[model samples]
Target chain A: MILKRVFLNRLSGTWMLITLVIILSLPLVIGIALYLKASPIFESQSLYQLIVSTDWSPCNGNFGFWPFIFSSLYVTVLSFLFAAPICLFAAIYLTQFSSKRLIQLMHPVIDILAGIPSVIYGMWGIIIIVPFVSDVLAPLINIKSSGYSILAGGIVLAVMCIPYMLNMLIETFNTVPIGLKEASLSLGATSWESVKHVVIKKSYPGIISSFGLGIAKAFGETLAVMMVVGNMVQLSFNPFEAGYPLPALIANNYGEMLSIPMYDSALMFAAFILLVVVLVINLVFRYFIHKTQSQ
Target chain B: MNKQKEIEELFFKFLSGFATYSLIAILGFIIIIIFVKGFGALSLDMIIKTPKGGYYYGGEGGVLNAIVGSLYIAFGATFIAILIGIPAALYINVHLVRYKRIQNTIRYFLDALWGIPSIVYGAFGFTLMLFLGMNASLLAGIITVAFLITPIIIRTFDEVLSTIPKGLHEASLALGSTRTEMAFKVMFKQGFSGFITAVLLAFGRGIGDAASILFTAGYTDLIPTHLDEPAATLPLAIFFQLSSPIPEVRERAYAAAAILTIIILIISLTARGFSKKYSKSNLK
Candidate 1:
């Protein structure tokens, strides 16, 4: 019985270790698989040409990702611009100024917002933001848009990102030692001054990481952005113009990809670009966070 | 100068408050719009019947196929995630208790995996499907979503397990229990509610995700009776239906969204409630 029990323990231990190795290698496996799938496009075109050229015709087997890359960057940056200030201010209000009761109440609100599926967000974007952008905002700016623009995508993405970024910011602010804030307060600084100088300063790394994570998220968002961004492949910096982001391009073209030569490769390459960008963003921010915390 | 500083503080405070309220208002707007628009089209028929002929063209039918398919995929994925995640989390906390470096390395990998977008998983799953000579089906969707949510499950369960005091580990081993026994018997029992919460949370995510299953889980009108059969998901249903030029079909999309939203809301609230109730009972 003793020998049997010992052997079973050993077996379970091996099982656990094997599972651990599998889990650990998953990201690498995914990266390699995507690279292999996307290698055909790389072989077909020079890396610079693939990324810098605007030609996207799949029938003639010419693929360039410049427009999609530009769109993803523009939308992500614009959404960050839209969401960061609001998230920062709202997080400050919740953590610094609000009572515990209010913070508690906001938890579920943020959770629900974050939990709502991207498709619902897309539907909401189509129903509300599209019309408002085309009829109201575009008219106000004297620009005619088809209601499906990068601006609409940005607004919807900003709303979707707000809860995520705010959650992180609130946690970051809350991590600021209360005594530090109190010390600033006792030094004749006003409450806002204490928060501005102490809390924000102390959590600066956290705020940066949160924004980085949020940008990574916004960059790879597919369905909602796909629904509103009009899927138009264009090299335009105009937020009111319809542009196809990388993930949107993949999601939109994957169905018909098998029917066309090099189409699947192009789409796979797009997915590869998304995965690498998001992973790099996460790694940088995580390293920043780890360095600050270690200090 | 002091008065100016005070005014500035109040003005900034007001701005912050405005920002906070606007976020809340946006949440309120999302819920209200979904429910109000969906309520008109929601019906017993919508929930109970599968899409009939011409359903995408505003024909009479429901999204029963998608609903059932979603539940099947989510439940299957959650089950797989639990099977892998629980053991993995337990192994990290119990078996490798002394190896902090390895634990952190493993955690870093999990975090990276967690950060990977679901679309990438969908793409990866598609590649895997092609390599394996498999068609898009319920099993493909389940496996794909399992990949997407397993990191979530492990991370959440790891957090819960980490919260248990260090003393429990030593105490259990002191009683001469093996690591596997201690993990399955002591730690698992203590964190059982948390395990439920983690599984539910993962299920909620799995069910709501559309991108991960978009290519792998081929859509069909009929409920999938076999693992290899195509399965429709609610999110994809809403996606397809909302894009239809037909008004009725678009309304059905809202109804589907509302249903998905309500399911997610319930899962999250239940997870919250479980965590709150059991967190107190666990040993500090």
Candidate 2:
């Protein structure tokens, strides 16, 4: 019985070790694979040459990534523009002025928005949003009717990102002590003035970090942007133009690259870049969280 | 003074009202669009029929295979993640590995793992499967998802385990329990529901993910009878059908979207309910 107990004890320890290795090693292995694949593309061909070339046709020898990079950045910026102000004010309102009943109603709605699958987001975008944009939004902008454009994709991504930002910022804002707000109010500051000057200012770091996380989510978004971004390679600022961001580019072509190793390698290179971008943003948020707690 | 106070109160009320209404409107609009399109495309065959090449129309097909495939992959991945992630959480928090820097680096890598785009994981999985000469197997897809979701489990598990009062562990040790016994019987015993909640969160995330499986799972019309074959998932079905020129395929896509949304909603609600129950019971 003693021997059996010892064996069982050892087995449990080994099981934990095995699980640790599996969880930690998989991404590490992938990170290494990405570096190995990416070095040649960047080293043999200069980084500037690879990125700045406007043409992205993989069928020929051209491997420019400027368009894709710009599109990703553009969409992220536009989405943040739409979501940030509304979410920030909403966070302020939720934390300060809202009643219990209103807070109760708003919380689940945000949770549901956050919980809905990205593909469903995509489905909604393609069916209702794309048409609305093509008919109403496109005509207003005086562009030809292409339902799948950056504007449509950015608007969808903006809505998707708002819940995340609002949730994080609401928590941040709530953590601002009520005592500070009351003291400021008693000292002749209006509620709006107290909120604008003190509460929002105090939570600015958390708010920025939360918005950074939102941008990260937008930057890494795949399905919604993929379906509605129109998948064009042009480098125009026009929101009506179709575009290909990194995730969209990777998703659209990875399946059909049956035989071309170079094409596969280039896509792998893009994936490596995307992984780095995501990792950096996540680390920043972690740092910000650690910093806030330490403070 | 009374008039000024009344005016200020009215202004605050107006501001709050408008802000809350807009936030609610955003969510309301999303749900409306999702269901309107989702319901418009729903059909009976969509739940049962499989996919075919060329026009996904004029044939009896359902998402039976996709639904099953998503569950299989989600379950398989969560099983692997829990098996690995929970212990790692304990080890990091309790074991205090001899090499703190190495352990810290691993923890950071896991954090980064959460942020790594699903497509990158898919590509990584594709490469790993190629190395093993297992082309697009269900096992490969599960591995990809398991890697994708491991950080979530670890974070939640660590938070839950950390919140257990140190007194409990000390009491367990005072009672002559060994360190392992204290961890398993004392610390982990209290955190079981939280652990399950963490696993369920990972399960929901794994199932909702479409990008990681796009390349690793590939596409197969046949329902996966075994883990060796390629399988279609609900997300992939929605992706392909939305792009299809056929009206019939589009309708099926909406049904699949609705089903996927409903599944996610149920998982989320379950997790929320479990946490609420735990909080309530502990208060008494």
Candidate 3:
């Protein structure tokens, strides 16, 4: 009976370890797979030329990713500008000034916002934000726009990211010890002063990491941003212009990629870029989080 | 000097409050808009009947195909995730309890995996299918989505398992139970409710996701009858329908969104309820 128990234990342990190995290597496998598939494009054009050129005539075999890359950066940065301050302040309010009951009430709201599918957010963007931008905001700013501009995408992306960023910021602030806050209060600091000085100072790494995570999320968001971001391949700095983001490029063209030479590879290269950038962002932030926690 | 500080504090406080309320308002607005627009287009026929010809041009039939397809994909993916995730999480927290560094490293990898965008997964899955001489189908989507949600399930379950007291492990081992036996019998029982919550959360994510399955799961108008058959999902359904210029098709998109939202809401609330009940039981 004892021998049987030992054998059974060994059997399950081996099974569990196999799964652990699979989980550990999954990211590496994906990264390698994407890189291999994308290598075909490199045979035709230098990586620098592919990324920097403005021409994007897929029919002519010229693939320039500059426009899509720029658009993605513009939309992501704009959304960060729109969302960061609000998320920071709201997180502060929830953690420092609000009652526990109020925080509890906000949980469901955050969950629902986070739970809504990206496509639904895209649909909402089409029905509301697109028209609002084209009719109201664009005219007020003296711009000719089709409403499917970087600004509309940024607004929609900002709202989608708020719940995610705010949740992280709130968790970060909660980790600031009560004793530290009380220490500031005892020194005759005002409540806001204590929060700004003690709580914020202590959780600075956490705040930066949360923002990093939020940027990574905004950068990779596809469906909603694709729906509203005009999907036009153009090199434009103007927020009111329709621009194509990298993910949007991939999502829009993957269906017909096989018909064109190097098109599938080009799209795969786009996915590779997204995968690398997101993983790097996550790795940097994870390192920061790990360093802080260990200290 | 004091007056300046007071004014600054008051202004910052007001800003914080404004931001908080605005966020709440946005959530409320989104929910209201989806329901209000979707209600008009929703009907029993829409829920029960598959789309007939001319559905995209706003003729007849319903998104029953999408509804059934989404359920099938979500269920299949979640089952696979749970199968892989539970064992991996259990191994980390139970079998590898002595190796804190290894546990944290594994967790770090999981976090990075969680942050990878679903669209990347779709692209990768497409490439994988091509290499394997496979076509887009239900099985392809299920495999892709399983990869997407497994990290979520493992991380959530790992977190819950970590909360189990160390003493219980010691006590179980003292009773001459093997480590594997203790992990499966003792620790698993203790964290069972949390495990359920984790599975439900992963299911919610899998069901709501569109990007990961977009390329792998070729869209069709019919419910998939076999693993090799192409399947339509609610999010893709909404995407295709909404993109149509026809007003009627667009309205149906809203209805589909509302239905998807309702299903997600149910899953999330149920998970919360389970966690709460588990916590209450612990308090006893």
Candidate 4:
């Protein structure tokens, strides 16, 4: 009986081992397949020509990614510029200065906000934000059209990114030792002084990490941008009018493809580039988090 | 000295009070805006009926289809992810007898996968699905979301398995139980709650995802009768409706967003509740 039981155990163990092997090997297999498929197509296309091409007329053979790339960076940078200061202040207010009860209340609220779908954010941008931008902020920003310009998209993106930034900053600030802040306060420093001299200094790495994550999150976003970005597929420095990002371009056009290898290859390269960019940003953030935690 | 100290204490208390209230005000404004903008659009028909083509409002268009698609895709993603992720996690945890270096390398890849942006996953899945010629299929969306959910479940299961005390496994083995039975019956039983939480976490993430599904889950108005067809999901529905120029569609968008928000809220809160309950029950 014991021998039979042992045999059954071994059988199950073997089954599980094989399952594990398959699971662990899937990504590697998928990666190899992707690289093999991408390499042959990319070998013929000059990277410089592809990057500089202004025309995205896939139907007519133009597949320039420069406009889309520039638009992505432009809107992402603008949104980060708008979001960083407000989020920094909010994080400081929550962590260094807010009372425990307030922190408890605010944290869940922000969590819920963070949980809200990006799709809703797009709706909010159109119904509440676009008009405000078009009628009000557009004139101030000196853009003629407030309806679908960079300014509108940037503001909406900033709002979408704020919760992410706030969450990261709050977590980072909480990691700062309370005793350090108390020590600064005990030394006749004001609350703000303590935050500046002790808390901020200690949490700077995390704060920077949050900034990088915020930028990456904004840059990689698709649906929210798709709704507000107007899918113009053109390159423009102005905030208003239509523009496209790589992810948005793929999201809007993936369904329209006629199974062309060039189109597929373009998308693969774009995905790879976006993946690399996001990984680089996240690695920077991870390094900061590690460095700060070690200290 | 006492008076000066008291004055300083009073000043600090006031400052803390002021700062705390302001933080509350900031978070409060965000919730208030969502509720104010979204609440009025809620209706019974909106919750139950399907949108009648192009006419987004007042035509008894219901969120029933989207609700089902969200659940279907999320569950599909969770199923595939668990099937793959749990074994990998278990192997990494228990069965890594040789090539520890290779195992660790794979483990690091999973960690990196966890941090990869959802949009990139969307793009990758979009391109891959297109290449596979399964354009706009729910299965493609499911696979995409599965890719997104993999690292999360693996991490959760791996951590849960590692945290289970070794004594349980040892005792099972002493009783003549095989390594597989000991791992599955004893360790898995101990880790069941955490495992459930991991699944719930994956489900919650799958449901919350928008970018990853946008391309693969190609938006369709009609109800999905099969897995091969393009189906509308709550996120995609919300996106299209909100972006619609029609006021009725906009209203439906609000209702949809509100519904989605509520569902996600429930899932997230439930997942958190399960973790707490399981941990507490285990302690008792």
Residue pairs in clash, model 4: A149-A239, A149-A240, A149-A241, A150-A239, A150-A240, A151-A239, B49-B62
Query: Which of 1 and 4 is ahead in lDDT?
Result: 1
| Candidate 1 vs candidate 2, TM-score winner | 1
For each candidate, the DockQ is 0.76, 0.52, 0.82, 0.38
Model 1 off-target regions past 4 Å?
Answer: none
Query: Per-residue lDDT of A239-293 in model 2, one digit per residue for the tens?
Result: 8888889899888888676576478778888888888787789788867865685
Worst 10 residues of 4 chain B by lDDT: B18-27
Candidate 3 Cα errors over 4 Å, as ranges: none
Error of 1 at B272 (Å): 0.8
Worst 10 residues of 3 chain B by lDDT: B275-284
Off by over 4 Å in 4: A1-44, A52-55, A177-191, A259-261, A287-295, B1-39, B53-60, B90-108, B130-135, B156-193, B219-221
lDDT of 2: 0.80
Instruction: Tell me the tens digit of each residue's lDDT in model 3 across B141-173.
Output: 999999999999999889889989999999999
Candidate 4 lDDT score at position B241: 73
lDDT of 1 by residue, B1-284 (tens): 99999998999899999998898899999999999998888999889999999888888899999999999999999998887888899899997778877777677668768888889999999999999999999999999999999999998899788778888889988999888888888999888877988898899899999999999999999999999999999999999998888898999999998899899999888888898888888776
lDDT of 1 by residue, A1-295 (tens): 8788788888888887777777778888898999998898887899899999999899998998899999999999989999999999999999889878877888888988988999999999999999999999998989999989999999999998998889888878888889999999999999999988999999999999999999999998989999998989888877889989998888887888899988898888888988999999888887776666657
RMSD of each candidate relative to the true structure: 1.2, 2.9, 1.1, 4.5
Which stretch of 10 consecutive residues in model 1 chain A shows the poorest summed lDDT?
A286-295
lDDT string for model 3 (A69-179, tens) is 999999999999999999999999999998888888898888888888899899889989999999999899798899999999999999999999999999899989999
Task: Indicate the TM-score of model 2.
Answer: 0.92
DockQ for model 2? 0.52
Model 4 lDDT per residue over A1-295, tens place: 8788788767766766765666556455545544554554466567787788887777665678898999889889999998887778777777766668877677556656566667767777776677877788778868677476666678788877887888888889888889999999899877776877888898888888899989988888877777777778777776777788877876676655546657766766676667777767876677667555655
Model 2, B197-227: lDDT tens per residue?
A: 7988899889988888988987778789888
